[model samples]
Target: MAKQKTAFVCTECGSDYRKWQGQCNDCGTWNTLSEVRLGSSGGSGAASARSSALSGRRGGFAGAVPESRLLDDIDCEDVARFTSGTGEFDRVLGGGLVPGSAILVGGSPGAGKSTLLLQTLCHLARTMPCLYVTGEESLQQVAMRARRLGLPTDQLRLMSETHLESMLAALDEHRPRVVVIDSIQVVHSDEIASAPGSVSQVRECAAALTRFAKQSGTVLLLVGHVTKDGSLAGPKVLEHMIDCSILLEGSDDSRFRTLRGQKNRFGAVNELGIFAMTDGGLREVRNPSAIFLDRSDEVAAGSAVMVVWEGTRPLLVEIQALVDESQLGNPRRVAVGLEQNRLAMLLAVLHRHGGLQVGDQDVFANVVGGVKVLETSADLALLMAIVSSFRDRVLPRDMVIFGEVGLSGEIRPVPSGQERLAEAAKHGFRRALVPKANAPKHAIPGMQVIPVGKLGEALDALEQ
Candidate 1:
């Protein structure tokens, strides 16, 4: 008789445990452990059953192990790419979609993941056959959305099914160059007794589709749902199985949606794609910096412009701060688009080094345009903005600044100073305050570069 095995698995990290627990020790997620049963016969029986299940699958590649080829005999030329026709989309993929690639995209429910994929497939269908399989939405719902979005459905095929085998069969019949699984959570294989979104089922379905895409030279795109904590739903292994992982980050009320590349096998990671949600669908933001900066005729107090390097592009984002007298016993400190803990650290530095006391004031900071600044390069600008708010002074409208701030009140140079300065110059910024180490030998045309060694000197530059 085949042995019946039971184990507790974590839905967040796929860690296995002998017993149920309140929290997942590996991932630190509470109440995510689920009990699962596994059936396994003796070695021969288990191997035979697995072989039988995979043998007849449509996406399976034929032939046994082949003779290994010498490394020198392999071709190193660029792999052929199929453009989805969206410039920003293609750029995020590091040029265009490779023929045998599998991409996983995850986002909050209304972050526009489905709509963006639909638009991409609709555009790609104009040149090649595209298939969109929806396990959550019905055929009529997808069709209605296509009509509402004014997308052409001539070459695009929609299938409202959740069975993995049936989806594979359709892939064989249609032989589409591009296939989109509108979320992998709902797709399940009959062979797996677990639920659709369970760890086992999600892992199996993703592995099957990934193998199929690679063996058939098809561009496979899988849509995934994110948990409340902003991680992809299902096992974490699902992200590891795909060729690329892209995240759509934004809020319901925000006009701009940020598409960030988390992991990529064909392109650079951390590349950003900006989009604007409109009635007509998502429109790419060509000049992202302009939208992130204040458009008022005069520069406001407590607002400072900083050049931030996001992947290959340099974006000029405004850092705004407001310091007010605290009404409560303890002062309040708040930060948006910046780390709160880092904000507290910067406040301490302002008091200890710059001698600007804000212990009794409520300090609030925000980065304009819903953009989050993660790099330490914005440290100088953030501190300056806070100081400006404290003193009620306005920074020069035509100036930009960037550099890291040390704990001992020293301003340190950041990477890519030349690139950041060049971008500022292109935007007609006349002045720049950078670290002394980052100052260029030859000044940029139409721009003055003032290199500051200490934090106090930067504050003095604001006065000038």
Candidate 2:
């Protein structure tokens, strides 16, 4: 008999240590170390091998192994997809689910991860065999949700199981083409001694399921829980083990939800899928721009519209800013749906070069409709909105602006200039103040393009 060994693992960063420590050396978080016992792999090798072999009974590890072949020898023209009947969902999955692909969907609690997956399974069940296996929720509870959504329950099979071995047995028995695990954190393997949701248990169970999915040619959808910092919980290796990772984000009380593809092996990365939550379920928002933009004729001060590229689509979003005299010694700077640091930098540039003094004012800014403005293309619009608020002047109602501002006060060009202009034109925008480099070869019909070489030129256009 061999003496058992124990090691400490950081739940936050997944770094392991030889002994227990008060603070994690890797992530610098205090008291995140959890003890995990290491078991001998000698005697259990045969039993574990038997377990893996048995787990792959339904065409698991034995059948789906790929043979070594040259790139020229492979044929990929006939790759098939399992369409879930939802256009937005399929878009996020890179034009539908590929056979034997494992996808991990993660989000904050109440972000509607389970609801979206359930709705998808309902649609997939109509065409092919689909199973919704819930480790967190009961079968009856799932049935209630299906009834509430008015989804037909004839084709989809519901199972409530947490044990990994039993789940594999069910997979072998049913052989559904598409299967969804409500959450990966709850499912536990018998081989791991640590508790469920622990580092060792999560890693081993996710690996086992990923192997099973690859071997059986099943489209596996695993719901992952996010940490307090909005990242997927559990070991970082869990994210690397999947074929694709999708992040579902939005406010809890808001009706909007954005599905962003962070990592995709078979499809393009940074793809976006927008959905609107309703009583029936999640409905696809075909024209997301219309919802984000305020279409009223009234254009107020401190408001400007800019075209932003979310993946390949150009969306027009309204940027709002408010500047008020501060009574405190240090003026407050608050921004929602935009980075505060970026705002501070822009303010600095505005004062130094653009001749806008905002140091004495408590600055507040927000992107309308809860859409986060990550790209610097909105730089001109943000600064314009701030100036408009400070000067009590409203910008032209028919104009759209987008250009990246530099520290030296130059208006830099952004990518996809043609697409952004076309999007603005579609929305009846007649004038655009863009960077000189982004000027199109031919003028866009029904729109006047004003190319600005510097930040001051952009302000001159608004004043005129």
Candidate 3:
């Protein structure tokens, strides 16, 4: 018998190697290489025939030749999209789900990844043919959850299978307009001689399903498992094969979940969808700004509010900072839902420019409502919050602040500044301290626009 083919593959970057190594040469990650079996060189004739038939190729170079055309020759018409019966889900998908698109949704266990998809597919089944294929759960289990969630069970089709060939056969028989595989990790292909969730199995199964979706114009929704590090648990190549990649994130303590698009070919990747996990199911949070800004009645010293632009809309989030006397020689600088490096740099800027020394204090920063602030627009608000904590003074409760503080203490403008200010004003913010360039020419009604150009100027405005 011929020797079975084997190759070492890197789980981090999907780099292939002939032999096992301690570290991946491509991504520099240690202990991520795993052996993948590629089947025997001298397989049975039946297996070879099955492989060839599944690939739609009878023999070598037997397929029709393709012709290349100029890019201008292709149609430029917009692709049609169908709603998934969830506005937040649709918003994260750029607007709506496109026909023939392959979408991957990944999250931690109990993060409601399956629940969200079930609700969507159930609603869509009323209008169009939809299928729910589960390899991770029994059909009865899915039905029980659906019934508990109060979803309609009449039209939606359900299947429980892990074999890739059998799933494809069922797809051929059903010809559904929408199909969801409640997870890609458990599905295995017979062509690959490996257990399910292996790199080869995941790559092959996802590729085949994506190809079928493209050919049949079916909306393919794939649920994926996340690693302990909160990343998708599979070969990195799987993300490249899909049209969109979305991650559902929620902490155990919080009742809210956030859906964010990491990659999208049809829409913007920066869009965010917020959902509130209820007893019935995942309900969409239409006005996320209100929920995130749900602060207590009494204002505190170390808390301040800021406006952040999430994709097409503006979000109002609170920034909090605590400055306490350090007990150790080296002060601890911690940031939750914010970048630690940026926090340290902001502290340095405050000490140098504003003449406020916090080097001997332990500084902790947090964004309210578990919202991660990745933009520099939170700089001014963070600095103000820090100063408020240091001085033990409470900022105006109706005030909003957002601006980028540069290394030289100059405040910079962020994108969609006018809209951000308007959003804050709409939310009953009376005063605004923003970059001078971002200040609106006309005064906003029921709002005081306080534009500051320098860090010192902002500090002076806070005192007044």
Alpha-carbon shift of residue 144 in model 3 (angstroms): 0.9
TM-score of each: 0.92, 0.92, 0.94
Each candidate's lDDT (Cα)?
0.87, 0.88, 0.92
Question: What C-alpha root-mean-square deviation, in Å, does candidate 2 show against the real structure?
Answer: 3.1
lDDT of 2 by residue, 1-464 (tens): 64566778787777889999999988899998877766665657657778877887434343553467999987979569867788888888888899999999999988888889998888788888888999888889889988999888888899999999999999988988889988899998887787899877888788888888887899999999998888888877687789999999989768999999999987877888899989988899998888988557776799999999877678899989999999999999999989999999999999998888889999999998888778899999999999999999998888899999999999999999999999999999999999999999997989999999888888888888
* Candidate 1 lDDT, 105-222, residue by residue in tens: 8899989988999999998898888899999988998888888988888878888989999999999899999999988999999877888888778887898898889878899999
Q: Whose lDDT is greatest here?
A: 3
lDDT of 2 at 105: 96
Off by over 4 Å in 1: 5-7, 18-25, 36-39, 43-74
Q: Which of candidates 1 and 3 reaches a greater lDDT? A: 3
Angstrom error of the Cα, residue 180, model 2: value is 0.6
Prediction 3 TM-score vs. true: 0.94
What is the alpha-carbon lDDT for the whole of candidate 3? 0.92
- Choose the strongest candidate by TM-score: 3
Q: Once superposed on the true structure, which residue ranges of model 2 sit more than 4 Å away at CA?
A: 2-38, 43-68, 76-78, 295-297
